[model samples]
Target chain A: MSFFKVEHLTMKFGGLMAVSDLSLTAKEGDLIGLIGPNGAGKTTVFNMITGRLLPTEGKIYFRGKDITGTQSHIINAGGIARTFQNIRLFNDLTVLENVMIGYHGRLRSSFWEAIFRLPRYKSEEKKMRSMAGELLAEVQLDNVADEKAGTLAYGQQRKLEIARALATNPRLLLLDEPVAGMNPRETGDMMDFINSIREAYGLAIILIEHDMRFVMGLCEHLIVLDHGVTIATGLPVEIQNNPQVIEAYLGEPEGA
Target chain B: MSERHRREWIYKLCTYGAIVGLFAFFLQVQNQADEYQIRILNVSAVFVTLAVSYNLINGVAGQFSLGPNAFMAVGAYTTALLTLSPAEKELSFIIEPIIWPLSVLHLPFLPSLLIGGAFAALLGFIMAFPVFRVRGDYLAIVTLGFGEVIRVVANNVQSITNGPLGLKGLSEYTNLWWSWGVAVFTVFCVTRLVKSSFGRAMQAIREDEVAAAAMGINVFRHKMLAFVVHAFFAGMAGGLMAHLITTISPTLFSFFLTFNLLVIIVIGGLGSMTGSIIAAIIITHAGEWLRAVEEPMAIGPFNIPGIPGMRMVVFSIMLILVMIFARQGLMGRREFSWKWFCGFLKIGKRRG
Candidate 1:
């Protein structure tokens, strides 16, 4: 049995088939990449996996549990976490508060205990604060932990988004175009950061990226999609040389 | 204890001390002030309760809901029906006989208030399902329509609401103590809730619902929590307002009431609890103080005739000026924390 698997996942919007019969599996610490052209339904795949959209037909099994079509928060609580292509930090909240929100699902104390400031709530709150502080420190954002998240630099904001996703303590992490808008140096740094966290957290990562260099250099395995169909899947070197993958990207050499 | 811990302890002590001082002041005012002054204070305290709870949904949770007036009506009517004596119900319901369960079900003021609030919360819970299906301007319109629907029902339901004549001449149970005590409690609960993890989740939803859900924060549940809590407190405030004025009709909880609360929250700073409290007090008093503009005045040699409703015109202009100059309202989403207070006094490091 696979550690994580999506079997025959299909998503349809009215008559438009966004993703059809997409199936993949990952081991406990596998690093996989989903590469496609713009509008090839990459985000739709993430949305389906994260429960933002219900798949038309599919089975999602995570750690021997069929988590098909569950609510997004419940899916997240069951150990799947994702980041968006667009950074969606709680911009008005402080950096620390944004991370602390990631731990909200695992909160042991009820709201009544929080309202009354009971001993349990106090202890839990203290623990949450410390954990949030550690996450900020790990992300090199501890110096600005008290500052509003909106004021951070773009690279820092991206890091903060990843930090927040990690705060959910997920075994599976999905990255939607993790380095979408970045200079080469920043992209390299992000690749290194993703690698470090993948090893440190022992996570199975499935990332979507348009950046070919980042995807080929970092991902051990790759899947190429074209028009909602997986055209090729193999080791990174094999995928790069595959004729079908080339046809999908370069488009049939004009006359052929 | 460490320096930070000691400072926190002192802060807690000072907060309790201030609360005691405030209650003592309320006692003094109740004993010495005239009925009119006491009435104004009660009105302000009730506004505080309404504004703070209203902020939980509008400011904190960032949902555009306009049905608080309807919830208030539900609360006020529930309390009025529950607390009115059976003999009094007989006298008040001249058009149609009072309803069976309500006519015979007379209770003390406290329980009646609690039941009223609970009833309003139940209505809020029911409304959340349909209301949250829409967002932004659509949400405002839907909630506004909800308020009208409740008002229309109250107007037509003679057996339950005494039609448009409304309940009148009830016992004056909302004194300074009851009104201010509830106001203080509302502020305390809302502030504590906002500072909790649940509050962070709500704010995260306010920031971005998609991201909040992906982070394992239940968006709908937090929204429902905020809505129900808001409804509960607004209902309690309605109950207090009902007893303070000793009368309530369907007209009492109209679009105008909701509009007034919107003005209070906007002028107070959308997400600031302290801002809501200050704005409520200021707006409540300003409504009375600005009435002088409506009265005829002899300035130098010119004598102007008094114009009814002129107070509202001046109030609207003042609101316009505030919007133009201070767009984020008075506090601009910043709370009044102990550290900020000490910093303002130049006795500690500035922090918020």
Candidate 2:
């Protein structure tokens, strides 16, 4: 069974079809790339899979269970976590607090227990704290765990977002423009961190990126979208050689 | 004992000790204090409760709500109906006969207060369904509308609320002990909620609702929780206010009541519970003390005729100045903790 799958997914916004009949599957431990120019519905796909947006038509499955249009929290609880293209850290909150929020879906303490600070709440909170610390450390942000998220540098904020997503203990992780605004060194560091976490946690990652080099270098398989429709899907080498993909990226042949 | 165990013990001891200390202090003050001082303290405690409860939705949950007074009205009216004697109820509704079921029923203070809070919470829960669907300014307007609707309903319901004349001669059961006790409890519950995972989720929702949802938080549920909890406490505060003031009227729970709470929170810092507590005290006391300015004063040789609403003018100026200089309010999301307090004292366990 596939680890995660999106079959015949389509999204419409008024007159615009944001995603058109897109289908992809990720096996356990696979790294897939969804790439396109600006406005290619890459983020829309992530949004739909995470249940932020209900697909106009689609079926989303995680480990053979239909999760299409499930409530966002339930989808996250079912072990799918995602980051946004625009960094969305709880800015006024500490980095540790931001990650702890990601652990909310896993917490079991009842409202009364928490309000009263019962032993169960204490233990669960402690466990969550340590786990948050670990995730912060994974993203190399443990040293600044107490710092407000808004005070972090842009690259660090992106890392914090990923750390927060990882804190959910997701089996399938969707990263939207993970290294969008990073310098080469920061981008390289992020790529390495992403690779290490995937290996360590046995995560299947589907990432959307504007950086072609990062996508080609990291992703094992690629699906290219243009004008909301898939133009190509295969290994990076095949995509690099495909004329349609080239035309989509660079526009139509000059002579024509 | 282990360090963690020791910390827990210390926490428990400190909490109970503080509660005991407050009771002893208030008990002494209740006997020695003048009626005016007691009244000021009672009002201050109610404002503290109101400010903290308001912060739960506006500050912690990041929903711009403007209808706390509506929930408070629910609590106030409910409590009044429940606690008023059948004879008193008949006397209150002089314009029209008191409703059958309400006129016959009466409850003691504590249970009546709880029921009032519960009713307010129910209203809050119902409001959240539509109110949470909109956000920012729209959320504010919707909630404000809810508040007005409540006021209008209270105005029309002559049999129950006595319409314009309002309910009077209410039992003054809200002593400083009751007011401050509930105020402390409100602070405790809110602070605990803010420190928990649920609190974090609420903050996350405040920061970015979409991102919060993507991170697995049930945004609507947390929003509803914050709203209902806030309304519950606001309701309790209203109940306390009614008993303390010895009257109930539709006009008392107006937008101005919410506006007063808003000013306190804005001055205190929207997301800071400690700020809310401090600001509540400051605003309430300041308003009382400023009464001197509202009265004719002999300054030097000339007797200056005090301007009516001068207190409000000065207060609005102060609020505007605070907004200009300290945009995040006094605390800016910071809370009071033992470590910080100790650090402030220049004593044991200095913050590193």
Candidate 3:
């Protein structure tokens, strides 16, 4: 069975269809790239998969269980985690604290236990703290663990967002424009980091990126979309030479 | 037990010890201080509880609720209905006959306070659904509307609440010990709550609700929890204030009362518990001190005629000045700690 699947997913804003009949699938350890031009509804697809938007039509199944229209947090609890296209760190919190919030889904201590500082709360908190610390270390953000998240540099903020996402212990990780704002060197570093974490965590990943060359290099399977419709889906090499994909990117040979 | 558990136990012991010490000190003040000073102190304690609880919702959870006064009304009425004697209830309900069940029952102070807080929390839980649907200024309007609704209900419930004439000649069971003890307990609970992961979740919600939800924090549940917890304390504080004054009416739980709490939290840093504690005490005392400005005064031989509502003007000016200069209020987001205190005093090397 596929590790994750979105079948005929559709989203509508009034008369406008934001995402139309988008079907995709990924297996264990598969690296899928969702690429398109600006306003291609790539983010709309990510939002539907993460339960931020209820699909107007279609099913989103994780491990063969239908998770359509589930609450975002519940969807996250079901072994899926995601980063925002624009960085969404808890800016007022310390870097470590930002990561610790992602561990919230797994913590078992009740609110009363937390209020009373019960033994269970204490032990669980200690476990989460060290785990968050280790995750930060993995992303090379341990040095700024106590610094406010807003104060971190752009690249460091992206790294912290990933570390925080990893703390959820997800089976499927979604990256929405992971290298949105970065220099070429930083982009290269982020690509390597993404590959390493995928290998280390042994999970499926679906990334949305506009940088065609970068997405082509990182993703094993490519899914191309333009105007809320999938134009093509296949291996990176197959997608590179597809006539429809070329026409979608560069307006139909100008005089066909 | 593990070493961590042992340390925590020790910490609990020290906290209780400090509370006991405070209780003893307040008891001393009750005996030695004049009636006016003692009343001021009691009022300060009640306000402290109100301000800190308000921050839990408005500041920490970032809900911007303006219906705390309604919760306070629920609590005040609940406590009054519970603690009033049958004869007192009958006498107070001359405009209409005393309501059944409520008129027949009388509870002691502690239980009455508990039931009052519980009732307020229940109201908060009920309101959470519609209230949480909106955000920003819309939330404020909805909550304000809720407060006005409660006040209107209180005005019409003559058989139960004695109507606009209000309840009077009640027992003054709220002394320094009761008021200040609850204040200490409230501070302890709030401090512990904000320090825990639950508190962190509330802060995360405050920073950004969408991001918090994405991170698997149940946004609605957490918001409701903070609202209910804060309402419970606000209700308890209202109960204390009602008993201390020996009276309550629909007018007592007005928007002005909620505004007073808003001022307290604004003067204290929004997300800082310690700041609320200090700001509550200062603002409560300042309100009383400013009363002198409202009364005519004689300096030496010449007499100065006082402006009746001058205190409010001065307060408004002060609030505006604070907003312009030190907008984060007293503490910003920083908390007070013994270690920080020692460092400020230059008594020891700084520690993280």
Candidate 4:
């Protein structure tokens, strides 16, 4: 059975079709890339799959179970986690606390137990703290774990977002522009980091990225979109060579 | 034991010791202090409870709600109705007799207070359905409207709330022990909550609801949890206030009560429980002390008529000054810990 699938997905906002009839499937550890120009609804597809937005017409299945239109939290709890295009760390919380929040869905302690600091809650809390520490260390952020997340540098903030998402122990990860505002060195490091985490966790990643080199290098398969419709889908090389994808990216020649 | 664990044990011991010492002091004050002084202490303790609970929603959860007064009214009235004797209810509800079961119902103070809190929490649960749908300023408006609606209902529901006459001659069960005990318990519970995984979820929601949900936090559920807890404590404080003051009226739970609470939480630092406790004590005592500004004064034989509401004007100015100087309030989200306290003490010793 497919690990994750989206069928005939569509999203409309009032008069505008934000995404149209988008369909994709991923097996266990598949790294698929969704590439599109601005306003091509790449992020909207992620939003729908992650349940941030309800598809106008479509279904999403994860591990062969229908999860379409479920709440985003429920989707995450079902082992699908995502990061925002604009990093959304809990700014005021410490780096460790931000990651701890990722473990909240799986926490076993009841609210009253937490409030009373019962043995179960205490043990769970201790485990979460150490695990969050391990996550931060994995991302080379252990040194600054006590600092407020908002105080981190841009690249570190991006890394922290990934760390937080990974803390949720997701089987499928959606990354939106993982290297949106990084220099070449930072982008290269992030690429390696993403690959390492994917390998370590055996995660299937679907990412939206504008960097052609990064997307081509990291993603085994590519789906190109333009004007809310898929233009091409295949190996990165095939997507790169496709005339429609070229036209979508660089615009049609001066004349038709 | 490890050094860190040893330090933690010492800190725990110090904390418990401090609490015991404070309770002993309270006992002495209860026996020795003047009535007015004891009353001020009780009022301060009640405000501490109010400010900490109010901070949960407004400060920590980052939901701007202006409905604590309504919750408090629910608590105050519920407790008052439950605790009052049947004869007292009959006497107070002259305009219209209180409804049947409520009129006859009577409970001891502790149970009455708990029931009041439960009722307030129930109201919070119902309100959360609609209230959590909107956010920020819209939430504030809806809650503000809710507060007004409760007051209006209290005025019109003569049989249930005794209408405009309100409950009177309530027995004063709010002593130093009760008020301070609840205050301590409120602080403990809120502090524990803020340190829990659920607390992190709430803070995540505060930072960004979309991201929080994407990270697997049930945003609505956490929001509802904080709101219900907030309403519960606010109600309990209201119950304590009614018993301490020995009277109640619909007008008593007006927007001004909420405004005062807002001032306390704002001055306390939005997300800091320690800040709330300190600010509550300061504001409560400052309010009483500032009453002199409202009374006529003669300085150097120059008689001056007192200006009514002058104290509030001064308070507003203080708030503005605080905003200008300390935009994050006194603590700026930094909680008080034993380690910090020790460090502070060390600094003081070195200076001396």
What CAPRI grade goes to candidate 4? high
TM-score ranking, best first? 4, 1, 3, 2
Interface RMSD of each: 0.5, 0.9, 0.7, 0.6
Worst 10 residues of 1 chain A by lDDT: A247-256
lDDT of 1 by residue, B68-91 (tens): 999999999999888899999999
Docking class of 3: high
Q: Of 1 and 4, which scores higher on lDDT?
A: 4
A3 in model 2: Cα distance from truth in Å? 3.3
lDDT of each prediction vs. the true structure? 0.93, 0.91, 0.90, 0.94
**Runs in model 2 lying further than 4 Å from the true structure:** B1-15, B298-303, B347-352
DockQ for all models, in order?
0.90, 0.82, 0.83, 0.90
TM-score-best of 1 and 3: 1
In model 2, what is the error at residue A87, expressed in angstroms?
Answer: 1.1
> Model 3, A38: alpha-carbon shift in Å?
0.6
lDDT of 1 by residue, A152-207 (tens): 99999999999999999999999999999999999999999999999899999999
TM-score per candidate, chains pooled = 0.97, 0.95, 0.96, 0.98
lDDT (Cα, 0-100) at B237 in candidate 1 = 92
RMSD list, candidates in order: 2.1, 2.3, 2.6, 1.2
Name model 4 segments beyond 4 Å from true: B299-302
lDDT of 4 by residue, B1-352 (tens): 5999999999999999999999999989978999999999999999999999999999999999999999999999999999999998999889988889998899999999999999999999999999989999999999999999999999999999999889999999999999999899999998899888888888899999999999999999999999999999999999999999999999999999999999888888999998999999999899889999999999998998999999999999999999999999998898999999999999999999
The number of the candidate with the highest lDDT is 4
Those runs of model 1 whose alpha carbons end farther than 4 Å from true positions after fitting are B347-352
